[model samples]
Target: MVDPAQILASIKTHPPSCLQATKCSSHYFSVLSGSAKHYMMFSEKICWIGFCLVGSLTHVFATRYESGVLELGIHSLVPGHSITVDDDFVICDVDIEVSFSHGYSSPGDLDVGITFDADSPVTTGLARNHSCGLFGPVHARFDDSSSNTLAVNSNTCVSDGSDVKPDGDLSLFNGHSSQGSWTLSFNPSRGYIQLQQWAVILTPCDDGAGTGDPHFKTWAGKWYDFHGACDLVFLSNPSFAHGTGLDIHIRTKARYQYSFIESAAVRIGEDILEVGEYGGYLVNGISNADLEKLDKYTVTHEKINSKQDVFTIELGAGKQIVVQSFKDLVSVKTVGASLEEYGGSMGLLGEFGSGKWLSRNGTVMSDAIAFGNEWQVLEVEPKLFQTNQFPQHPVQCTMPSTSNVGRRRLGESIAEASAEKVCGHWGDLKDQCVYDVMATGDLELAQAGAF
Candidate 1:
């Protein structure tokens, strides 16, 4: 029963002293001044004890063995310097060794808890009130503890009971980078617990190069729909081992008729194969759920064998697009039947004919036929769209529109009532009304006061 708030409050009020003990012996003496004694104990059984006026009774334990007494030295704890882990490393497992003084009257008198990064607490044998009949060292291991064999010593007592078990698995840190500051906190609820040593093991994964060529390069950029009719875009990036993966992001425009990515494939060197398919439908008008499907697209083959060149994309049925990449100038073509119809050559050495089509900069001579009318490349910072960026249907106010003088309340102007009627039919152009009203300065403040 360890309360994190109470432990943190106690540590703030009574900070333990940092002291060095020069002698090692079977008997140790400590002089505590106040009711609450705060002691920082190190591995060598040495402790720097301090006192505070917290009015809470803390039990002190002293144990003596026939062979020898454990020696611990208390050192000043530094905030950031206490522990340092490599930035690129990934934690695989953790092993901690602790020793508790055997001066408790009963088994439940001692409780020891340890937490990493303020996560859930992992307890020792003392947490289950394991009888301290014979105790010198208790080893608690995370992940797998079957490999660790408890060492038995005549002078030192070891816990071999089944009351204590490992707390968490290494999967908690899987896929998470090991660069942040990891806080290892120790909290003892009932009795005094001494930490001997702890170790964290790391296993690194190959990020870019493993079996593939280290110098191999892949294309990574954003491709927008030629016209903004359909709120959909293609993002191509290099997966592990320099493989190409295409992610389709769709923003449905209408309700009931949801947009779905039935299948997706990339044409590489005249060969066409089904790359992957994300068979899920995204509901229109729900921006959050639809945006989440952007990253969930399936990439059948991560590594695509192709140079930095122009590639044709075959998206499901009746839809095709071309991506032209030269250095950093990434261009996309969408308003054509196929790569042959668009007159675009494939691979690194090929180029597309600049027919009666718009260029990458979105300068259009004629409107795109593949996408519906009213299509333009609204360029912003190249990033994912937010919830507010999605088109929202105009809300229709269902309040009664009454023009009678008796029904109209006091201070309600006729123009205000007219604007309300206009808003109900504004539909999708409701957002444009606000801008038009501001630009033209047509709606007088006195007349459009409610608007």
Candidate 2:
């Protein structure tokens, strides 16, 4: 629903150096990373969002939400650079890349530090009064999941500094809100450092769903597959703005020992949009023609060679749902502001923001089956779908007895090498991609993994 032409026109008004702003499928994010000094904008994988050079000492990056890595560049470093993260996920890891035109005589000459909100500056591995020398561009990574220790590219750099706090690395900011301003600072005591470009790669806790075989990557970045055939609540926020928030439900059908999402119904306020296989959709039990007149939402249907139907449902304000369907396989994704609004929400998608699977009784359900079954649409809840599919509310959701155990091993039918080759691009979901391809014997399902 984002108009590329309008975005391009806005970019033209900026200085010529900030000409390129890469827009991805979910939303528009502008950042720079990888081995190059310039922004490397990937088509489908990562998004290089908005870029700007406001003043000599400060650079501001306004980034929209979505899964994947976001790298924002700052050419200068004196006071610091401020990054406003509008994404839903919490900051789990942060990678800082600093490039100087020349090397420093000693690492202690320049003190690099970062601060989130009012928190104290976290020096990590970059600090002053150290015995190491800054030879070239350096990459410092702070990951909370792996270790409290900060990982740096240079062997000469010390892990801890004179002023390093106990929680110096990203562990200090882990589980904190990803929103608000993050300031990066560099204080040099000696000669001009001449920093060419410095970038921050922010990796948030992402959420996604693979339709066939029905693997779900929760908001907390945990992967689990549920093979339940029934109409279930995918995500629900009953208290969103006076109980008119988003209510999404999905219809699933059994396929061998697995299940595929047959359709999805999304309700926002008074409007309901139901999408199914093969480019079929209905708005409030009526034809799709009414979507054009709606003010709160916009829907776009792109059918490639009349084979696959990709629907992008854009709810006003940065919230969106992208549904990609190839043949009968369907995958759905919620990105940007959509995720921002669903903090502490419920359903099969798990707890929004925190990713804790909680039942209606507010009990944390660790088991995927219990979590999935806990969200089955209750009989009293309003039904959004027009047709009453089998195994509806009031009926216990049907599940495969074996639950993917001893079920044809991955790469058993499909060549292991070929499956890996096809699914390698899936990143963290690589194994899920291979499993979906092998489970359904459909190569196109792996292609839809991009959703």
Candidate 3:
């Protein structure tokens, strides 16, 4: 939204000025041919105000001595500015005033006509002439009693001697190149017509001729999980708002029986969190309480390419979430989970159906006790996880206690057995041995064996 106050301020700071002007014969004159051209400049390709044309005239020289003329012609060299002949130029809101000084002797025989050049492009290459009767020659007698006003292209002329018409069109001169030539020509019969005065207004187009502010680009489509394991799909339509700002909407659904979970979470600039259906927990200076206070997250900036965007997720608190986006994937670097939170002997663990974990500093843990057996602890440098770089495999690690650990996949019972052994090392610690069995019915317990 544009601030009206700002617009007013801009107007006050830089007032509008005439970009160009050209005038010929403001005083009454008798001439065979006359034309005026003006050059204009628009600061912006798309300007608010273009230009205007103003002039006035009156018909004369049709008395007993001089003898009335056949017709008077007015033409505009510009594609759309002809009054005498019908052309591509569309003219409206005519307010020309006409009056008779002397009475007419033969109003019907002596016709007063207005015509334009037939070569105008607006005529579609066809020269069409249009004329209307001004007054009857019989009623030509008038001193100061005969005067009239008519709108441009108005079929109805004022019956009263004096009148004025206010509505009309002048679009031809409104929205062309900011810098161009505009010429208006007038020809009168026997030097009888007199131009009084005229004025017109024009407005520019909205798009600013490709230089408008608040430019936008949009992308809308569907994406699928890389593995195709769970029929997981994402329908997203994201619109760019004011360069860095963004509005994103994504609908995620799972078609298969597998539970879909996110390994990371998105943060909406210290104000919101758009948690998916499967709720998760925040970490690293962010707490569940902080997440509760936040409004539903609406994206302000979308991650594009590998460029990292760090957003403050807790207003004023300074907590941030770093994110990177790829073709169909997003990598969030916040300490958060995309699944149910569970406390373990090492730290906390949030598990996804893809056997991935969101853990604190590589301290391995699992939502299910038996599930621990499926993963092997690996010793690698502690670096940020790149969603596109790593292979789809299970991994676990115990930090501080050891710098390097090798991972080995084992069977369900083998994992249970190993867990029991590790629990035994704690020497009858109740919580150490008694693990939470949160697995669903289908994964409760199958044939327990060694891997």
Predicted structure with the largest TM-score when compared to the true one: 2
Candidate 3 achieves a global lDDT of 0.23
Which residue pairs show collisions in model 2? 29-48, 29-49, 30-48, 30-49, 30-50, 31-48, 31-49, 31-71, 32-71
Candidate 1: the clashing residue pairs are 44-71, 44-72, 45-71, 45-72, 46-72, 243-302, 243-303
State every prediction's TM-score relative to the real structure: 0.28, 0.56, 0.19
Off by over 4 Å in 1: 1-42, 45-82, 92-105, 109-111, 118-134, 144-164, 168-170, 205-451
Lowest lDDT 10-residue stretch of candidate 2: 36-45
- lDDT agreement with native, every candidate: 0.28, 0.59, 0.23
TM-score of 3: 0.19
Roughly what TM-score does model 2 have, to 2 decimal places? 0.56
lDDT score, residue 155, model 3? Answer: 28
| Full candidate order by lDDT, most accurate first | 2, 1, 3
What TM-score does model 1 achieve against the real structure? 0.28
Model 3, residue 282: displacement in angstroms?
25
lDDT of 1 by residue, 1-451 (tens): 3343454456557544434222211211122332211121222323343211111122223333345645332222211112334343323223333334433234443333333342332322213333343354455433333433322211223343222233333334433344443333333233334444333433332111000000101011111122121233332222311243332222222211112122222322222222111122112323113222222222121112121233344443444444332221122334222222222221111112212123333343343323212221124412223232333223211112234334333433334344444544455433333332332223331122111
